[model samples]
Each structure stands twice: as structure tokens, then as C-alpha cells.
Target: MGLEADDSSSPGETVMVVMDANRSRGNVHAIEWALRHVARRGHTVLVLGLLCEIGKRASCFPFHMGEKLERLGEGEVDPTELEEEIARKRDEYKSCLQPFYRHCKKNEVKLESKIAAGLCPRKVTVDEAQSCNTCWIILDSHLKKDKTYIYAHVCCNLALVKGKDVVTLMPSKVILQKSSLKHRRVDDALLSNEPITDDQEEKSITPPPKTCCWYPLAWRTGFPRYFTQSELEVITSGFSEENIVQTQDNVKVYQGQFQETPVLVNCFSQNDERFWSMLRILSRVRHRNILNIVGYCFTGSSMFLLFDFPFMGTLEINLQNDDLAEKILWKARWYIAVEIGACLRYLHEQCVDGLIVHLSVCSSNVIYPLGGSAMLANFMTAKCLKDGSPGDNQSLTHCLNLQEDDGIAIDVHDYGIFLLELITGRSARCSLDPDKEDLIDWALPAIEKGSLSEVRDPRLTDTTDDRLIHHMAQAALLCLQDLNRRISMSEVLAVVRGHEIARPGC
Candidate 1:
């Protein structure tokens, strides 16, 4: 097993990377880059080597590949066969990881290694990493030159299952390893489409925009300034536990004020490495419904991502009172649906490239305003197109094509779940009890079975907006489909936007 951390361990300090040991050479390079990047800033790193049997599990090897090979040779079945292969592969993989381990060790880079044997390498790696407060994951793209998906599917599967922040480093298109791979230039995908009107097309097609780096302009010119620990402490009231608004996967969110502006402090568990990339991505994205990243602090190995504090907190808390979810008028409910749809539209179209998927969108992440509107937060579990990298044009094109169907579809599914949450005032996947293992699981059965009114929140039942309710119910049904034939965001938006009521065209 790769390096493992026990229960009492800090969560965000160590960076655990799970990759194919057979591709240890490429992974080793990635680990080195991570270590150097983190170490230069004085952060510790952990590299986990997961050794998983391919095509079959360790138990099946003898019966499958080894037994066949032996029978062809006309030799006796070797009982020690599987163990010998495991031992040999383990040794070979260890040797491959040794050089990088030694380099980090020599530099006092604070690195650790662990080896794990399992059938579900990706799940096992993610599970093991989660025990130590992993906040971000960096994966190498598994696409070969033929444009056929390589390990990209593996990485995507892991991301989909885990719903965490993951960044994939792509290969330069010029170094095409597969002759059949078709990489489109990024500009053609992001700029040439011209989503803006004719008058605005010139502005949209202009030169590339400036990169939004977090460091201040003065610091970019060499005048660096940082918040002193003592100052930060006073500024944040000593990171007061009472300031904490929510906690998820070892991340504690605290509401505070920085220079009289509302700020939410996200103190991560120690082992998370994706903090930088997460912060970078969130900082660059601008959307009304999405939570805004105001500023952040990276002190040693720890990070505190500061965001615009959502005064309303989360829908989970708001609905717990029973009054807000039920007492909120139909107009307010419709307003929320419309606003959230608008937010998704912005994420789909207004971004530099194509769509950015909020892989894990749920009630817990939906923050409602005490008055005005609601917004989505928790980008620690989001993914976006590569905007400024060398092969960005190609990546952008591929991402745009992918968004044409896949990305938007996934988002529509997520938003449909959100709609269900709004209607039922319950989680999409509930675990409180059998009665509520997600509103979808419970209400969906009723919805399918024709208990229309019963499946809806009693709060919304009193309202006589049959067409709107029917449309929303239908949209949710389309979204809940496990197949790719689910409704698209544009389609959902069209239905929800046009059917829903707005106050006197305001």
C-alpha cells in the first residue's frame, strides 16, 4: 500500500498521488514537479504508489493469465505464482519510485511513500488519500496521440466518483504520440464561435485577456507583502471555531471580515495539495450564481481560501427551520430556480473556454441569501478547461466539443437534482434514514408511480402553478436519467425560464 495516514493525522499537508505503477516513469516526473512546487513554498508532500493488477485481480491471475501460460508450456501449476509476481512487481515499482524519493529525502523535502495492493486502484487511492485531508488532486492526462482516450477515462472516472478538484496536465500537441489523435487549436474553439452579438463580436475576438494571478501587482513588480500570522489571527479573531459556518471533508469554513468586507475563511485539512489549483481556477471564474473568491492565504503548507461570505448561509441550514422552505412564497421559489439556471448558463457560456462543471452540486453547497438571492459555493470540487497552457488551444477545442454534449448534460443532471432538492426540501442523496436516502430515491419512485402532489414538498403543494410545477417535475425526471439521453442545460433553461413566473417583467 502507498503511504497511509492515521485518523489523528492533519488532513491537508501531504499530497497523495495514485497512478499506474507500470507508468511509474511519468508519475515520478509528476511527483517531482509537485514536490518542488510545494517544497519551494515549504510544504510537505506524499507520493503513494498503488500497485493494481490489470485486466484482472491478483486472485484471478493464476486462473487466467498465469494458468494459461503454464498450460501452454505444459508445466505444473505453481502455487507460489501470484505471490512471486506480486513481489516482483512491487520490487520493480519501488525501484522506479526510489530516485524521486531519494531526491526529496536528500533535499529534506518532507516526502513519504506507501505501496497499496488492491482491485479498485483509483478508489483505493482516493480513499487512502481522503484519510489525510487531501484537498486537491493533479492527474496526468492518459490520452494517446491517436485522439483515443487513454487513462483520461480512468482519471475522469475517479474524479466523477470522488467529486474532488482534479487537474490534468496535457501533452503538447506537436509531440503527437498517436497518429489518429486530432487536437484542435484552442483559439478556434474559445474565440471563433463569437457568442456575443455583432456589435460585441469585435471586442470578444480581440487579443487574449490578461492572466489573473492572485499575487498583487506591486508584488509582481517585486514588492512582496504578506499578512503576519499575528495580524491574520487578529484579523480573523484567532481563526475562531465559532466563526465556522460549515465543515466538509476536513475543510472548515469560517465567516470573518477582512478590512470590513465580508470574507469566508476556508481552513483546509493539512494533506490537501490541490489548494493552489483550486484557488487559481476559482479566482479566474466570474459568475453571478457561483461563489466569489475574494482572497486567500498560503502560509507554509496550510491554505486559507477566502471568499465572499454568503450571509444567508446554506440551504441545508435554512430549510432545517422548516419555515423558510415552506414559508417562502412561490415567487421566491421561482426566482431561485431562474437565478440558479442563469448561473449555470454563465458557467456554460461566459467562461473563457466552454463549460466548467461543478462536479458536486448539492443543497449543502447552495447558499441562500437572508434576503436577496442564492449562490453556489465549494469549488474545491469543480473542473474547468485549460485556458493558458501551451496546448490550450487544442485542449480548449476538445473541451468545447466535449461540452457540446457531455459537460452540459452532466450539469443539467446536477441542476435537475438541485431542482428536486428545491421541490422536496431534502438532499438528492439522503442518508439520514431509510425514509430519506435522498429525495430522488424516495420521491422518484412516487413520481414515477403517479403520486405527483405527494412527491412534492408540501410547501409547494399549496401553490396552483400546475404548468410550472409539471415542467419542473418533468425536467427533474429527465435529469435523473442515468443514461446520456438526459435533457440538456439549454433545453432545461428554456423550459424552466419560460414557464416560471417573474414579478411583472422585472
Candidate 2:
């Protein structure tokens, strides 16, 4: 229950309200009433706080119980103690009133606070209202019993706010009514159309048809919360162009924020089988050097996979831009090779089920988070070759032989091309140039001649450690071998890490 407002309250007027500082919900509701029923834009809400001393009289206060209080403005009270108590109590009231500050600011209304400790709550409230020239004083429900006393002593118009405690509004239990022993549902239209029998009358009314609020459901492990298509729409802001981070082959990757954590959402135009395969692979895989899935979404005709938003985009972008390339020092470049190689090694050899091949490993698929090592990404073509046997290798035949280990060979070969791009700032394209030597053709001949400068990225400092580049070039040349002579990922990892000391092939 709440009290009535005075008819005299007008726009731009000052409103004086008394409420328990600790009960934030009730105080806000009481102020909301003042804003709506009395004050408007440009008005001022002057909140009055009364900190009563600890006594039998103070126990009557309906809010902020169990707090320490000291006698104020008393004959026996020390002056220093009174000042400290008043200052401390004012700060307490200030903090409790924080919720109102934002609400009042948005409404174009000014809010003020006045906190004082006293023995008589009624006398102190009336004196402050008069001194501030506030004629309409609003009382909290805590002071409902004192409303009569306030109304008589104070000359201003008064209203006692009887706010409903939150607990009082808890949902009540539902009760079911028993059907009559000889009753049945008899619609007027159906009763006139067909005659009813005694047996039918004895039956109870049939329940209404049930409905389902549809969403995707599945049992999964090593995955985050599964989102519906609708949730993804809100996350990506309806998949707007402004949220797009990158678009390849006209397929856009959107960047969005979820729960204050930035995420990248990959969209598919159709419910492609590749999307599910990627989802299944990403859900089970975890590594420091891999861009793991944050969550995923499913729909009738589309799908989405969410990952941690890459801060530094692709390794290709960093190497291609000379201004940004400087950030990737000799140490970072070596770090990138080792980290990506470890990720590939983990996928090719260390899986519990079988070797998983990331067939799409490339510079554009490598994400380099700021200050962190490189990460492997773009698993739309990844396959779980259980028992090291080939599944569908139709698309992989051009670059690999369809052997038991051919799928692993394909990834190893691409990883070599990845290493080449790491040393020489060039893109990873498998096709050779007929006009002249392509990046691979030009670099392979240069490495054999010991002319390392011909293939080194010009953006790198000349004073950098040449030993690092020498080892990387050797690993790349070994990886570029013919399919029959290709080495396993473990050997490739060893060569790049300078553990096996691979020699450049003639």
C-alpha cells in the first residue's frame, strides 16, 4: 500500500523524501513515485536521512537494523565523537543512494542529500524540510507510524509511502480444482450437434494441447554453452557489415562481444556438412596454439561457430604490411613456427581416437594474438581420419596421394609452405608461376645455393640471428619434398625446433 500525493505538486518543484538508506529497492520505488506523481523534468529530489542513536527509541526504526549508532547533539556526547559519527553516517547514506544518482541524471532531474544524526526523528525531519524550503515531504513506509505526528507538527503537505516489501510479491502456489464426479465438458455447439451419453458425462475434461519452445539440444563434452540462431542474431547485430572482421571467398566472419568477452562468429550461408564436421572437430580439440571454439549455434538452413576474437588478425597480414611486420621480430617469427608446428603435431599424432588432419593450414588461417604465440585456425576442411585411414580424399588428390598417411602428408606439405611464408613475406598459393619461378621455385633454388638473402623477408632486420632463418629454411625445404619422401609431423617439429638439425635438400 502507498499514500496519496498532494494535488499541489508541479513540474520543476523540489521534492523532499525520507527513506531507509540501506533498503535500496524501497528507497528507489519511493523516489520513483515522487518523480511520476509529483515532480518532473528539471525538478530536484532532496533526500533526507535520519541516523538515530542506539536506544530503546531507535529500535523502532524499520530499516538498517544491527548497525552501530552513537548519541548525537546530546549533553553527554563528546564533540569530536559527534563530528566523526556524522561524517561516517553521511558517507554510508551517500553510497546507498548511488542507484538513484543514475536514475535521477537520466530523467533531467537534480538530486540532493542531507544526512544528520538526532534523537527525535520527527523533529529533525520537519526542521530540515523547513530550512531547505521544501514544502512537499514524502515519507517512507518505515516512518508510516510517525506520519500522523509529522503531519501535525510540519506545515508542509505530506505523503507516507507504504512500499510493498519484495518478499510480499513472491509467486503464490497454484491450486488445482477437482472435477465433479458426474460432470463433463459440454460446449454449446457440440452439445446441439451430437447427443451425449452417461459414460461421457462421467469422464473429466480433456487437457489442452501442449506446445514446445524449440531450441537446439544435444549431449556434448569439452564444449561451451550452445546458443540458438536467435541469440547469435543479437550477438552479431543481425550480421551487419559493420561487425564483420574479415570476409574470404565472400563468406564473412563477424566480430561480436558476448558477456564482455570479444568473440568471432563464422557464418555459413547453408547448413553445410563441413560446418558440422568443423564443429565436431573443434569441440573435442584443445591446445594453447589453436583457436578453440567459444561456442556454436545451429539453424535449419545456417550455422555459426564462435571463437575468441583474434586481436592481431592473420600472420599473413602482419608479414605483408612492412609497418606492422617490424612487430614480429626474429624471436617472434621462430616462436610462430614452433607453436604452429606443435599444434599440427598434436593433431596428426597425439589424438586419442586417431590422427586428425587440418587440411587447410595456411598463413591466412594462423591467428597471432597480441604478445602471445601463433594459433592454428580455419578447420572447415579438417577430418578425423580414424585409425589413420582416409575418408573422402577426392579434393585432396591434386596435392597428395590417396595413401594411408596421405592425409597427414597433405597437412605436412602445407605446413612447409607455411614455413616458407614465415621466412619470406609471401602468400601461400600452391600453383606454380609459368612466367618465372614462383615463391617456392625461387626460394628452393636460393636455399640450395646458400644465398639465404634471396628468400629472406626484406622487412626483417639484417642484424637478426641468421641461424634461426637457416634452420627454418631447412625444415621448409624438407617439407617441400615429393609426397613419397615426405617426413612425419614429429620429424618436421624436430627440424623447426633445431633439435634434428635438418640439412637443405639439393
Candidate 3:
């Protein structure tokens, strides 16, 4: 679901976490709460470590430290020695937070750290929070001593995590909300110091998969809402004709408003069957590049679903409009390729509940948000490996997992078609002319013949990056290979990003 305007949850917001890098003690609970609850895709978690002033010498600072050191009867500290100390301090900070780096990167959220020397924790935390313009700040109760001062002076939402299961949120000046959850047991799988992949290792990212308590596939506090029938009507302006933006597969889509933000309202009949199926899959999935359901309404003989309307409209819209077409340059198209591949990877491998098959993936179904990253939407034909929750129906889950599945092949193949469209600009041109040859028919031969230049979009001939194009074509060809030898989305994503994986050559 898209974030609400005035809500604490929104895209591109920062969550500032104040922790003392000295001891790893009270930070586990506070950081765990921030990542598991408050942070998600399109957000950044900044870990600010404000060093205490306990034995710090004036000679440790930059300028004139040499004079002070000389006056103290010792020569100036070696520049190399100072650098080593800073580096060790940074490594200490990274080790304390290393276990969670895998979680943030996997979810597509940015995880960053800063080291600051300060005299007081309160002043340092407030100054950093203000500068970062963060949406919320979670403090390790052990590190912050002056809670009353922080609560009054901090500019954004503040949370004081006192223990493993308790969090006190200062949502407003007049109200303080406290919530408790089951005692968290950190999974070893998530905390492993496994070596990172080559590309991300320099940044101290852990590449392996991490999950918490089965990733909370079951209904939780942050899941989409169930809007009443009246609520849907008010948002859609009583099904006004002018608001009708599209009609597809017997459903009417209306442009509407919810929480002062634009949204798409989809109306379906009671017996459509697709509604329940879509709801089941969409409810269980969340990714930065996958369009999510914000709210849904089911009443009487009609059903409705709400989605965050892309600020830039569908991919087809952007590619066809003359003014917008120029914006989808080769770089953007390459970015779109990587993003959609990652989105498919999440749906295919990361959903612990069950495998999801998005039956419809095309230019029309792809949305372009303001950030220009493509989001896969329109899951009316989507399905989960199990029809119901695994907790309630374990047999079904086991059965689906044990069988030979074609859903992955189908999605991978569709993604290959998408990559072709990206390079050739076939989707846009084909939409305008009904008689154009199928995208595969038009480009597959050139790709097979190793004539990539023949298939590149005319609009990008001068600006295209040959290296990325080659990698994209390689990944696409891998995807469009014999279904029996089809590649996985993770492999596809790696290739698109110019990584060479021993594929059985995928």
C-alpha cells in the first residue's frame, strides 16, 4: 500500500536510530523494533553513534591538536594513527549493526551510519535528527538518559524502547502511546555474519537471506485496511463517470482520493473469484517495486480494492506521450529492468508464506512512480501456491512446494518479454499500431544472431550503454530459453546489474 500523507508511514522517509556504539547491550531491542515495525522499502534507517566525552583529549581533534599535544609534552599524534582509530571505531559500529544490514538491503531500504563526537547525548541526538529531517527517532533507553528533554525538544516522532517487548511512542505533544509485543527471539539465520556478495561487500552488507519469526505472513498491525462500503463510495465520489479512468476484465477503475492522496479504486462483482485470489496474494506481499493494495472493500454483491496511484502513470503512458517519452532514456530503461527483476525476485524467493504467480505482467500493468522506478501492478490474475494461510492449511503448502511448478517459468518468461520491450521500445510502438509484429517475432531473431544493435530503440541509439545492453540481452535470452532450462529471477537481476553468475549459465 502507498503511504498516507500525514501518516507516520510514507515513502522516502528516514528513521533515525540513536545508539551508543560502545556497548551492544540495549541496542538490540530498539533497532529490532525500528526495522521490523517502523521501517520498510523506500525508507532509510540512519544509525547515529554519538561518542561520549569520557577520556577524549582536546588533542584528538583536527586543527591545533598538534600544538596541544606538544604542550602536553608529547609530539603531535600521527595522522595515520588518527585514521586507524577512526577506522576501528567505524568497524566497531558496523559489527554492532552488521546482522541487520542484510535485512535492510533485501527489503530495498537504505541503511547508513554516522559517527559524531559530542558532550551530551540529548544535544547530539536532537541535532542529528533535525539535520536528517527524519520522520521518527528510536532511542536505546540505555543510551538516552534525559528522556523528558528529548521528548519535548525532538522535532519528529520519538520512541523510547525500554526493554525487549516494550516501546513508548510520543505520537503527539499531549499523548504518549505504549505498546508491547511478544518477546522477540532473533533467528540465527538472520544474524549470521555470512560473507557478502562482491558488489555490496565494501558497504558491509550481508548477502544471505534473513527473516524474523517467519516474516509475519499472518495478519499484523501494518497490513492493508478493510474499508467499509460507505468508505469506498465517499472516496470514489459515488462512482462518478468522470472519475472512471479505465475498464478492464469487467472491472471499472476510478481515480479517487484517500487521505488527501490520489488512489485508484477498482470495482468488481461479488462472484468474480479474482477478487479473493488477488486479495490473498497482494495482502501477503510488500516490496518497493511491487504495487500494493492500500485498502479493500467487500459488501453485498460488489467488491472494491484501493491502490496508490502512480504519480507518473503507467509505463505505457510514459512511453507513448511525446513529452514523457524522452525521459525513458536507456539509463532509466536499464533501471526499470533491474527494479522489475528485483520485484520478481522478491515475489518468487522471498515470500515465505507461499509462491506467488503474477499471471499478468506487461507494459499496461507496470506503473511508474515519481521516483521513476517501475512498479509491477494489476494482480487480478495472481495466485498463491496455497489458497489459504499456511498456519491454517499446512498440507496444502507442503503439497505445492513438493510439486514441479510452472509458475516461476511463466513469470521469468514474461520478464524476458519485458526486457525486450525495454531495449526495443516495442511495447510503446506496438500499442499505437495494432498490426505491428509480436515483440518476440520482431527482436528474437536479431538477438539470436548476436545483432543487438539491430534491436535497440531508435530513440536511444546515441546514448545507450553497450555493456548494460549486452548484459540485459544475455539475461533476457536466458529467461526466454527452453522452459525446462528457465533461469530464476535472482539470477536475472544479477545479470541485469552486470554481474556474471555461473549460470548453468543463467
Q: Once superposed on the true structure, which residue ranges of model 1 sit more than 4 Å away at CA?
A: 1-231, 241-247, 269-271, 386-407, 435-438, 445-451, 499-506
Per-model lDDT: 0.51, 0.63, 0.65
Which 10 successive residues of model 3 have the least lDDT summed? 211-220
Clash number for each model: 29, 0, 1
Off by over 4 Å in 3: 1-135, 138-223, 386-404, 428-434, 501-506
User: What tens digits encode model 1's per-residue C-alpha lDDT throughout 123-220?
Assistant: 44444544664432334333111111212112111111111222223222221222232422222222232232311101111222222321112111
How high is each candidate's TM-score?
0.49, 0.51, 0.58
The segments of candidate 2 whose C-alpha lies over 4 angstroms from its true place after superposition are: 1-223, 246-250, 387-402, 430-437, 503-506
TM-score of model 2 vs. true structure: 0.51
Q: Please identify which of the two predictions, 2 or 3, would achieve the higher TM-score against the true structure.
A: 3
lDDT of 2 by residue, 1-506 (tens): 33334344455666788865434333555566766665667778887766566332321222222244434333434446555655665667666677778877898888887655545576667666656555467778676545544543444555655553211010000101212332222111112222223222111112121111010011112235688877788888988889997877545799887655567888876745666677667766655577777788767667788877777789888887888887787766877788788788889876544568888888989986532557788887787776433434431222123354878888988888888888887876534446554777778788867788978888886655787888788888788855567578888877877777764343
lDDT of 1: 0.51
Task: Please say which candidate is ahead in lDDT: 1 or 2.
Answer: 2
